[model samples]
Target: MKGNTNKIIWLTGASSGIGEALAYELSHKGYKLIISARNEKQLILVKEKCKYPENVAVLPLDLAGFSTVGNGVKIAIAIYGRIDILINNAGISQRSLIMETGLEVYEKLIIVNYLGTVALTKEVLPHFISKKSGQFVTVTSLMGKFGSPYRSGYCAAKHALHGFFDVLRMEHDKDGIDVTLVCPGFVQTKVAINALIGDGSSQNRNDTATEQGMPAEIFARKMIRAIEQKKYEVYIGGKEIKGIYLKRFFPNLLHKIVLRSQYR
Candidate 1:
């Protein structure tokens, strides 16, 4: 594994879950981290927990506020001089039927999950290109590869990220830019509680499988390893993560299996 010592990393959604865990893990490993999230308090807590607290910088940010990300990027770059990696881990989930979900609900999901990520990535592209070296690590979900019931909009946003970032990799590969798309099936995070409901309100409740999902710290470790190897795409999670392959190789069989699966 390549040690990330001295590498400048910009991580979004660092308030909790995998982002927070990754902040500590990477900082401990000697990476200079600039962590961002909407919750400044939680971001500070993440920094405080780092084994190398001085290596972590908390830059609280709201991805939904696309216009302000440029300023955030500027501040991060000013602090670190150059960013070697950008981890787009900030996103919200949805748990509502297509018909039951309001138009506003769909808009909010797409705007925050897809548009916000795209805006921030665009903001940092010039710097990466000029440096002729950088990595874009995105934390998409299994929903990105296969759609399930009650996650119509969430699926759309994740799928769009693949389309956009795949092209980015193709176009910038020669420029020393690397893109790693991480699709995890599920991990014990507050994703379900923060998920948007039919009326666009937070679910504020945990789902069955998610409650027993993989630990965020372990997920972050695997993610970092994948990023170090520059894998174009990697799936991290439990048995359910294999569905990505089953869906591709045996669509009909996967359909039947998923139909009987409890996750849906």
Candidate 2:
């Protein structure tokens, strides 16, 4: 995965944040990229910023729109004949309490963050199975490791990703398929501002924690190393990443801190 000139990598949510940073990082490594996002214009900007702009293509995709995911997959395949890796980075966050949130927001989160990712992977599964070589990379969050304030739905969706991908890795191991579940604690991205509120509207404001989180470029550099090493699971971020380990060795300690932690 390092300095591979012909490898094809398809990535969703490439319009901004970690995905955008990855476009540049992988481009520098000389990988052909099929970058997708709901915004074609922003995708184009990402492609232009790539080290090898000619090797990148903008594939507009809407994960929430199941009907369009398959088409996007086909177009991505058309770009490089086949994809060596698929990065599921397309997701939305939540920024409201469970009681204040509506059922519709939870449903949308499941649809886009969980089902949509699964659907895209399935569309590309046949290709990977036939070749018996490919990687599935998902960008989950630290919240996936433990429940947190103001993110019940987001946490549920990410936790579901862990369950689904663990099964995928186990079932496909014999087929030589690799899965990397990346749990990022937090990064300086617009995730907080774009998070859905109780009424299913965007939060429209960035939180202090997000403003001071790790830069997406640094996070992407570390991510590329983990991907190249073919890690099954890894966590990246600031001190918050420690929460994952704490949850494992000291459940009660983690539980107490998480409940009182004001993520916003």
What is the per-residue lDDT of model 1 for residues 75-108, given as tens digits with 9 covering 90 to 100? 9899979999999999999988888999999999
- TM-score per candidate, chains pooled: 0.97, 0.97
164-211 per-residue lDDT for model 2 (tens digits): 999999999998999999999789999999999999999999999899
Q: For candidate 2, give the lDDT of residue 30.
A: 86
What lDDT does each candidate get?
0.91, 0.92
Residue 36 error for model 2, in Å? Answer: 0.2
Q: Candidate 2: minimum summed lDDT over ten consecutive residues — where?
A: 1-10
